[model samples]
Target chain A: MWDYTDKVKELYTNPKNVGKIDDADVVAEVGSIVCGDALKLYLKIDDNDIITDAKFETFGCGSAIASSSALTEMIVGKNVKEVEKITNQDIVKYLGGLPEEKMHCSVMGHEALEKALKQLKGEKVEDHVDEEGEIICHCFGVTDDLIRRVIRENNLKTVEDITNYTKAGGACGSCIPKLEDILEEEAAKPASDKKKEETKKPLTNIRRMQLVEETITNVIRPILQEDRGDIELVDIDGKNVYVALRGSCSNCMVSNVTLKNLVEAKLREYVENDIVVHEIK
Target chain B: MERVVYLDNNATTMVAPEVVDAMLPYLSGKYGNPSSIHSFGGDVGADIAQAREKIARFVGADHDYEIVITGSGTESDNLAILGSIAYYKDKRHIITSRVEHPAVISLCKKLERDGYRITYVPVDAKGNLDLAYLKESVDDDTAIVSIMYANNETGVIFPVEEIGEFLKEKGIPFHVDAVQAAGKIPIDVNKINCRLLTISGHKFHAPKGIGALYVRRGTRLRPVLYGGHQEKGRRPGTENVAGIIGMAKAAELAMEHLANIDEMKRLRDKLEEGLLSAFKNASLNGDKEKRVPNTSNIGFEFIEGEAILLYLDAKGIAASSGSACSSGSLEPSHVLRAMGVPFTSAHGSIRFSLSRYTTEEEIDYTLKTMPEIVNRLLTISPYWDNEKQEGKPINL
Candidate 1:
């Protein structure tokens, strides 16, 4: 059984705002029965751009029902602009939390809400097809655009994470290498670039040391250790972070390239753009 | 908590009271290494031998020595498939059904990865095995043929006896995974002409952690585990003495209860009939006549199974589903998919397996409560239409 939160259980047991709005302004359906979940959303909007009412009809699991119920509760009596800003994370937070495997339930709610709003704005609403790219995960009919968007929104790294968030590589698993390529491509971009741009500053010596150590431990070590190697944060001086490669990494032929490319690139992405990683050899 | 009407017996049955009582002595005073030379342990070996004899008799095996007890049904399957493949030595091909339980299917998949050719014979729309395909797939390099006696999801019985006869004529090794069928239905290793068969204890009211593999005499089989001389070194680990005793007692009780099979079938048919008649779109998932008497897999169109299960659970009812959401997987049951079950109903499939302990009161309660659950879900189901009393067609 899934480790569902009490709130999720409660909502699933007695979901609110169920059924379709007969005379609603716009209706949108997302997901599919074959995909194991779908939601049809109904909305009644007032002339003042306020949501007079919101309701949903969901066909999925307990979390899916809870998410649809939570979505309707969160959207009713709110302005269209506010409802538009409600991400799947907001619905998850509303219900305390859902099991990671059921995160796609919340994503289904968010997608239905997005589709409803888009339909209300007179935009083309295709149920399964995405405007961004072709389908990638054929088993679940998840498109590349949907996969990439979920990856970016959820900050998903591994194929398992993508499966939990979007159900892209969860079945058959033939698209896992493609999922890995997508992860690598997405990881190349700086995480939260806007925040990085806003927080550009000269750091104190202690803070620089802390950031370098954190980066090495969190990011660099796992990669090196995957290859039966290790790295230790020996010292940090201004923009130059000194690291000691251990085990197989120490005797590696391309240790210099690894230090300059992988370790330095991570330190720069996490600590500072000018941060450099130096081997202690 | 309210009384739980557990219909998920196919997943695991409640340990029989008699079985538990039979095992308590082994857990307490009889806890001795069966391998020891002294009477303290030597007597325990005698009890284990008696248990094996009972189990062998229950499954209609010719000799007690043919039964190699293992950790679980999965281990028996692994030992059977891998052991037979090892015996073949040069043969690198295997034949299995598409609707097999993971114990056999996953092993076949791994063998495929190791450069072994695997033929996953398809099933018909009624969940019947494609026997002609199986016959055509067999060739000189076919190491073994592994197929389940009864599908776990649909309770559909394959033509194992026929397949067994054909393979017997061709001088090929055949393994039947009888985990779901052993106690529910009668199993005769000689009748099926199979070289190996697997049975789990837990499915027949025995405690978990014990299973057995029937290796026919003179079958060239290799041992999967290497260690102490237990089960003639076929499975070398220390015996699960308590579990073996429980299973023996359970099997004896099952033999006694075999006459009551028709009673279990009556309750199953009543539940299946009540549910199908109550819902317009509901239908059975497999061949109704050619299935194990204890199981009924019903599908309610236009709704997902997990949602229906949660509703059933709210009313203190327990059952199993073929929906992907139920298993934390993104695809519906492979058995259902292989049977060509439409997407409209595949996600909504639910299986109710009955045991001898099931009562008419529990079945009636489920029959009464299920309509309310299905109607409630229908109101919140996007494809369900209240006025039309039918599901809306969508491009799934």
Candidate 2:
């Protein structure tokens, strides 16, 4: 579960403006059911273009709901121009903090507020549209050139890593093939001597298995045996491993904890840090 | 250390103490390959036979020889579906419902790629399968009709026995993935007339990485994995002796405690009633009358399921969302989508699956804490704001 701040929880439980204002000067609806979150905002404006009253309805998770709720509370007494200037960062700050993944929830609220202001002024919301002739992955709005740049800079090993860096294919997932094409295109390019300075060392499966077995027998098993437990290496797949518990350790209640902390930690320290150890039954 | 309340038994269960005791010897001093010709091996084989008998008795199968142990419930599912398709290569059609676990769904996708035809039957708003569609989908070319006995997400019980009986008359093989329902509900493979059934050890109080499939004596299947001549070569690999022992012991315990299932059903209903009465716009997902004894899916309007889950977690209560697996990913649950649950309520659906371990105090605490959280999230929802606007026409 994501850790929610007190402020986020408070706003979630007792959201400031939660009803529709009749005869509002501005209204905005953003997101769709497919996106798994939607926000609708209503604004009551005074003669001076001040947002006298603001209310919101959101269909989303706690962060989305709380962020929308908080957004309404922040903008009700502010002028329309000021509301337009509210950023996602500001909304997140107002809620004390939001998990990084949920940052999009705040961005959605900010976008809805801006769209509503545009609707009030009889103007179009034109921020997301691009006129640069630079093709963005239409599915997720990640530019083709940006994907190339990320691949070139990060020296990324897989398409999934590129997703983490650029948020490409993170939404809609239709951009995955295009992203893969870019990765293959980059891999085909010639590399300078300096860029390929280090020689790749491929460890044999037998050697890898030996190292895992030794680590468990020499390090992990002894430590666990102190608690009347022991671990045996079961299977090794690259850096990932499967270990079986023996003796008293096999049926210990805290076996998962031991596997995660002791066995996995020791193997990662001695070998690669990306090892995922599963406890064998 | 702080006390942790484990209400997430539906996800997986803690092994029972007696089951653990039964498994201890195999993991330590009694360790011996069941296939070895030595005296130790004979002893191990005898224990495996005992476990097979216990599991067979638990599910009310006619013979202990019908059980074929495998790696996990997923492996059991794979073996049943894939193995059956392999045996009857002439019959290419497979029928199943939309709310199956990924184990079944992903395997079906793989089979589809391998040129097998698959028809996914739909479900009602309450997550109940359409039996008429199931009957319609099956024909002479249909090799197997695979459906879950009970849904893992909504806990809605499917009419497996009726479907099994229907297909038996037509001479088509019926396979039921009874992983979630095996221990919770009484299952008689002979009565259901199902040629194949799948069960996972971890769903009950058995350890993970061990499960069994009940293949009716005459059913033909090809081995998916090959090495040793274990499980009568139906599932050829070294046996998971300790896990099988634990599973048998767990099944025995489940059978012993079967009479008290009503107590769990009462607790689950009480939890559902409290949540529905306390929270506005709250309703249960799936048919209330046709669900498992210890599961309830409830939707709290205008609140995201993740937030509710986080709140419940913070309060030391463990529950899950129908959308939890797909929470980070934007896909609203396929189960909810298939059931035609409205998107608004589907996103807010929380699954509170109870176990025999769930207590009255825990239910009371959950009921008390839930309404406040729902009201809090709803207040800020833009959907709520939009509903209000729709209620009263706004004049510019």
The model with the greatest lDDT is: 1
lDDT scores for all predictions? Answer: 0.89, 0.78
Report the C-alpha lDDT of model 1 over B142-250, residue by residue, as the tens digit. 9999999999988999999999999999999999999999788999999999999999999999999999999999988889989999989999988899999999999
- A171-276 per-residue lDDT for model 1 (tens digits): 8899999999989988776656746666767778999888888888888899888878999888777887788999877976546646765788788778777676
Off by over 4 Å in 1: A191-202, A207-281
Q: Compose the digit string of candidate 2's lDDT tens values, residues B116-225.
A: 89999999989999999999988889999899999998899999989988999999989999998977889899888899999999889898889999999989888898
lDDT of 1 at B53: 97
Candidate 2, B220: how far from true, in Å?
0.6
DockQ of each: 0.65, 0.27
Candidate 1: true interface contacts recovered: 0.95
Model 2, span A1-281: residue lDDT tens: 56678788887655677766778787787765445566788889999978788887776777777888889889877877777767665686677667645655776787678678767778865433311225555643545765675465434546676654444576567778877888887867645432442253545678767777888788887887876777777778787898899887786544554576578878866655456898779
